[model samples]
Target chain A: MKKKENKIITDDIMIEVEKISMRFNLGIEKGFSLKQGFINLFNIKKRKELKAKRKKNVFWALKNVSFKVNRGEVVGFIGANGAGKSTLLKVVAGVMKPTEGNVDVYGNICPMIELGAGFDPQLTARENIYLNGAVMGYSKNLIDLKFEEIVEFSELREFLDVPVQNFSSGMVARLAFSIATIVDPEILIVDEILSVGDIAFQAKSEKKMMNMIGGGTTVLYVSHSLAAIKKICTKVIWLEKGKIKMVGGTEVCDKYLKYMEGK
Target chain B: MINNLKYVYAKYSFLLKQLVERDFKVKYKRSILGIFWSLLYPVLMMAVMAIVFSNVFKFSTPGVSYLTYLLIGLTYFSYFSEASNLAMSSVVANFSLINKVYMPKYIFPLSKCIFVGINFLLTLIPLYIIIIATGTGLNWAHLFLPYSFICLFLFTVGMGFILSTIAVFIRDMFYIYGIIITIWTYLTPIMYDIKIISNSTLQFLMKLNPLYQIINFARSIILYHNVPTLGQWAGCGVSGLVIFIIGIIVFKKNQDKFIYYV
Candidate 1:
């Protein structure tokens, strides 16, 4: 259960997250160099002190989180700040490994976890489109065929040869969103990415996402906008302090909203 | 495990090629010379080494051209050090992509080695040019030069994996590796002839370096126009295969933990 197993399945289940728990070191010095690592290795007293300090500093971001998503299910993750929504999504997307348990995802995933995650600012928008496509696991021939469509969707045809660093934030977002959604992924993992770009482009991207979802793509979406959740999610999982507080229909979103408002 | 290997191959091999290409484009983006700099770099370094050692230090090999000797050693050593150094920071440099995407982590370092290897192959143009200019006439033994290149490439990839993995945990690795490579370059007999060393034990120890084995094999084929001895052949191939195997094992063991650190 310690490994994330990405398998292909013939049945309906697309993702299975089993008791996945992730822990982070909350100490101020979260990272140590090899020099410090070596010093700690030789110093027994310091090692003992560090071990004791580690227990107090350990913070679990996700704990005993287990769930399953059927093919084409639009599942929304709702949580307050620091309630492990992003961490859970990362574990499901295979970006981060869980500390205790494992996750099994049964299909190709397009993780919109971070818009323009692999975009290099130094490269021109034309080059970045191909690079971003590669990062999302698309072959060159496929990207070549879809290149014109991506540029048209991004509406950056005039700025294709211009370096992405010179582009406005909206232009970058438009390019990222276009490349990410170009292919019809089997599982789409979105983490607050719908809020990208201007209002008009946001509407366009959401419409594109709805088209994918309508075509039987399983989606794991994390967002704070309850209205968006209620509109898009068929099921909602409300997380609280590293654990699931509720899992059900959109009514759970209503209940979570009440809980937040009451607090 | 076999199925997993196939899955990764089917999925990520194209991504690897793209990453290598990206490194190439970004590295040479603003430069006027573009990738021709790869060829000119070693040529310039060889000129400096020949002037300093042949004229000032009075170092020379009796039968072989000193410039050719220095170029071969300089070319290969730079390749190894440059590839590994770039690879050491490869994981940390790509942290933005690593944190958000699910691609295999080893691709970053492997891509760096490949990108540098392409540059290394370009440097060979100068290497062969100098060889012919020095009257070290081409011979049948030169066909075996690819053997040395293959061995050196494997060795560099192995070292890249290990260094990139270590870099994930130790941010200081970049600085620490700088000092180590400086010490290594001086020890590898790149400028001075190995025959000048007075102590047999010290010379034997120098021979223990895997880099020396690969470079020495290439020198034998190019400069001396002879096939490598059985010992040299074994030394080059065995060290590369052994180190590459160890590197793979080390990388695979630590890769899962990399997401936490990088």
Candidate 2:
């Protein structure tokens, strides 16, 4: 394991999350009193409570997580299905707040988490491009300038005026990817949005990511594809059950691969 | 505060424009009268109430025709009531945007309030014509209508900010709001005259309802041709500002958690 001192910030750190944790209360029920239940036996005073008691449950999605990413670094966050990777990414992107601790981020963040989430189904593809562009923090003028390029990238030029809900899932993914990468984001947080496209589109997305990294955009990538992570990420963070199992070079990922392979 | 305002405007200007246009377009899209329905609905309601209440209830109002008086009060009250009601659900309604973006949460309610304000102003054109057709001359105090509207706008936005924020955590707020608005409209003296309620105790209680002061002030200027009393105007100004300030504070503090709950 790397010592704590090794985690000290250097000159290029762009994102830092200090002791962050998120807790969600589930299964908490409200409405109906014991007295009301007893009185309802006679049906004299009817129960006004309409809602039934919901099951109670709680989840600690992320726990005491801490990490720092330097500028221009492409760090892959690899974990199992429930490993808190997306939660951590969302906190850094400012979409969700940490229940405890602090997250400090520098520069503009373009989060490609759940791409096409902001697109209105009733809106035309052209309108959705503008809407999604604005939601992703692009000014109208910038969206206008990139409009042609985005359409060309998505290969949906003929259907620009058609509503996005009419488009197939792969078409939506292509458009979402094109719109998300239209702006040259300083810090890009992509959460499995790129894995939906065809092989050709995947290659195109990989090329785009490489170009962005080459141009000094720091990326926090969360993906289950270990092969993709091995190819793109300069550093890797292996997470298990919301805890960091290891954080180091690509060698640490090899160890993780063996651990997963039951070798 | 100024910098925060600038930041908010710079960030949300696009969304504001989009939502406002969406509201204006979607509201009248399929209606036969289109935007004319803005004027028609209030006038029709006023006519019905004027006939039913003025004769059946025999309430005496001073200085203005009953139809004109009811139109003025109903027009202004409906603005606040409709804006606040829609604003109560603004945050929850845009769960997709709220979950994805991190802008000022207050913009959601404020945008709805502004959209309704534009509609309210449009509806006033017919009211002006109706007042003129009824042979009532205008007074200089009527110029103060714009200022009164500003006060009402601030108050509605404040209430919206608070209600929308609370509604996120409490799901039954929609039903609660329905009941509150139904009761509140009758209590605010919209269809009735404030002077007819002779009970001193009930009058005092009615005075405590902040909306009563707003509607009365509007009525005083537009229909009664008199400036609002100093105490009444001051109360409106002070309470509106206080609610707006506290509302922004609460919204800013709780905005981060809105994504989860919404």
Candidate 3:
């Protein structure tokens, strides 16, 4: 058996976000007309000499967010809708870049942010497993080795050869969860995906997550379930209106829950 | 450059496989002939054009029949045109995957190009049968077809990358692409031989269009049984390398902003 590495907190923060912010423009302007367009076209001689300045009209999705996650810590990011939880997770996963600050992450990240985003509807479940595994950065040999285990975990043995588009949402969720956990990444970032499966699948997913955490993997979990957050997370960060509201232990959940209820 | 290639291949190999299979399967799923449709469309187009243009124009294509000449040129041109059309919407078509996953964004465009390349390869079987059945002697230069295809593939990938990235930001790109492609086709010498242009100014303009050189290279080997000029090959090599590099730079720079635009 491969021995698990113990966590030593000697200035080894696994992930850091410093004043990270993301901005996006939301509206459109009037189109240029033929009269103004013709003048502007003739004015291109001057426009070529003068570099056109970019307009500044954009909204910030995340604002002045700063946090550090140490090794082997299970942190929950709880936020209301449009609170930038997904954006923050995407930035950490290296999918999206923050407009204002720097985000640094160490170690491999398996972001289960959008479960089965790479799935082809026409492809069979067996084919999708390999395709999904590869998309998640696993090699073909690695997928081959873990193929049986993933199929068993997904509980889709009979339907393995069936097209994924034919499968139910729960089945897809199960398959996605199984593929994600098969990799045993050093850092796992999950976003609101665990709530889709049934009670049994949820229990199985929780067990897998606990096992991953027990093996000293750092986790950043984003979900609306306060009960799940309280059960699984040791550290909590509450976000409201694209800003961090509070950071503390499970007790902060009570405050956040009250804030949500008060709204 | 090699490192970038490795990275792209590593990041996109899965998606490319899936898209290639999807491209082949989806087109043939309900049709009785399946993938034969890929060949049928081009063959039918070539036949119609050959008959229509052979009577109208009296230019002679040395060392090959007019049908053979037209088929070779049309086959190469169709690949380029179809690749650009597919690439125009590749990013938008895969918006769900692009918005969620962290892989190289160029994969969507490049995979679409590769999908069309596979279709081109499948379509070549009919071309080959026609060449043999028509008794056109297969020379040693025919073996260099793969190398020419690699050049064409690089060129298509470069163009696809640029167009797909632009399409993400520009809402009107989809509507404008067909008109652009129609104009580009006339600029290319697919129906007429490059030698037919007598004026020096028109020939210079034709040479400036990069697709002209690629199509000429393909037709020279396949139909004329002659190798492309040193200058033409050099133009293809230099342009392919430069465009590919530019495509990668543009794709990497703009990839982060795609989610916002989409």
Candidate 4:
């Protein structure tokens, strides 16, 4: 209901990230344990530094980044490693709350951040489908309705009864992709899941994504694959070191490609 | 609050069911007698403890057979220990899934408690069997046993919420709680009588333990064949509710930060 209230005011905006900033504590290794904490307690200089305003261990992963995506717009995030693309995606998907500012998303998000994240390896593939479906917020009856479609799409009919622990990585990826895309999500956040499985399965998954996109599912995509970005994205945001460096169409991606090539 | 509960139940009940089923299945996957272990574990533990306490330690039971008293207390206490221990790590165990998706983080602990609670309910069958075997025949008062079980269930869930939240930040709690539960078990008078404690202050402090009150409620109904006094019911209810509310408050306040730490 909290997510629905704002949709009434800005119906067209599928996602509105307002000056969102996310900070991660790099001090996890410093005093995380009780032993380390006790040791640090007596170290006066270290304690004073911890109390100081400019703490060295705080790393801002995203800084005052603002953007809005209208309904059906496929917005791509292009960035080098550690450039805050995944953190921003997580914030928009409502997985991680921003340290400052707000992210207002109008619809349910299917985040393909790491596929098969919910799969219990000890369980059979058949069981994992329902378990993963429920984790994805699907009801039992809904999953039952689409169970066959998922099995057929994954091409794992012969291996459904086998535990996921025995599954080849490609088969697991196929099943994860099929279950994730079974229902057309209201908003889809894809973080580097396009490279799933073998080449044939990759093409199949891309076609499935295109079908979802054609049905007006707003997408936030992040990938290092520039060609894939140019193929699917209507607009692109280039990130550099936790800040947005550029925002535009495929032309920005071309510029990014040239920039990377020069480097 | 009622409306909020209803909303959560409607939205996430299916997920909770799936999680419980997953836990149940994964726990019993390779075992021959899957759920029978729930029934057998308590009975087996009671057999071991009943001999040691009654023979070696010579603990006396005034009204009921020592077997019945020990089994009742052991059954209820096992649920608390098992449920709380599992619930403590529920959040940390599911970190991989939580890192990817947006979920009400409280569900992980809640699901763990419910799963262990189901196993606890199964253990009651053996408790009743032992009671009947010991000639403490079933009585109408035994119908009121659920009152304490529900209270204990709520108390355990609240403890679980608080523990699970702490576990997200401080990984040491898992090991620390093991020792705490062992010390708490001895302090609860599960295997021995409270009469052995000669000091009135010590006895009063022991009575203040919530597990003692809940277990006493069960003992009154099952062993004594009498309804617990109104004061006893009030005490048990307040302890359960107070702890449950505190757990929820702590869990809610800290849940948003779990993603960062987890």
The fnat of each candidate, in order, is 0.77, 0.42, 0.48, 0.81
Pairs in clash, predicted candidate 3: none
The list of candidate 4 runs beyond 4 A from truth reads: A5-11, A32-54, B1-3
lDDT (10s digit) by residue, model 1, range B124-241: 8998898898898799988888888899989999999999888888777888999999999999988888888999999999999999999999999988888899999999998789
Candidate 3 lDDT by residue in tens digits, B1-262: 9986896677567656766666665556568987778878888897788777887776557667767777777787789889977886888898887677677677778878888898899878878878887777588898867866887888888888888888988867887888998898877887777778899998998887777777777777877788777876787776677777888788878877788876
Give the candidates in order of DockQ, highest first: 4, 1, 2, 3
> What order do you get sorting by TM-score, best first?
4, 1, 2, 3
Q: List the residue pairs that clash in candidate 1.
A: none
RMSD of each: 3.1, 5.0, 5.5, 2.1
CAPRI grade, predicted model 3? acceptable
**Candidate 2 Cα misplacement greater than 4 A, ranges:** A1-10, A29-56, A197-202
Better of 2 and 4 by DockQ: 4
lDDT against the true structure, per candidate, is: 0.88, 0.81, 0.81, 0.89
Clashes of each: 0, 4, 0, 0
Q: Model 3: how far is B17 from its true place, Å? A: 3.1
lDDT for model 1 comes to: 0.88
Scored against the true structure, residue A174 in model 1 reaches a CA lDDT of 93
Model 4 chain B worst lDDT window (10 residues) = B141-150
Of the true interface contacts, the fraction found in model 4 is: 0.81
What TM-score, computed on C-alpha atoms, does each candidate reach? Answer: 0.94, 0.89, 0.88, 0.96
Q: Judge candidate 1 at residue B148 and give its lDDT.
A: 89
Q: Candidate 4, TM-score vs. the true structure?
A: 0.96
Span of ten consecutive residues with least summed lDDT in model 3 chain B: B21-30
Q: Identify the candidate with maximal DockQ.
A: 4
Q: Which has the better DockQ: candidate 3, or candidate 4?
A: 4
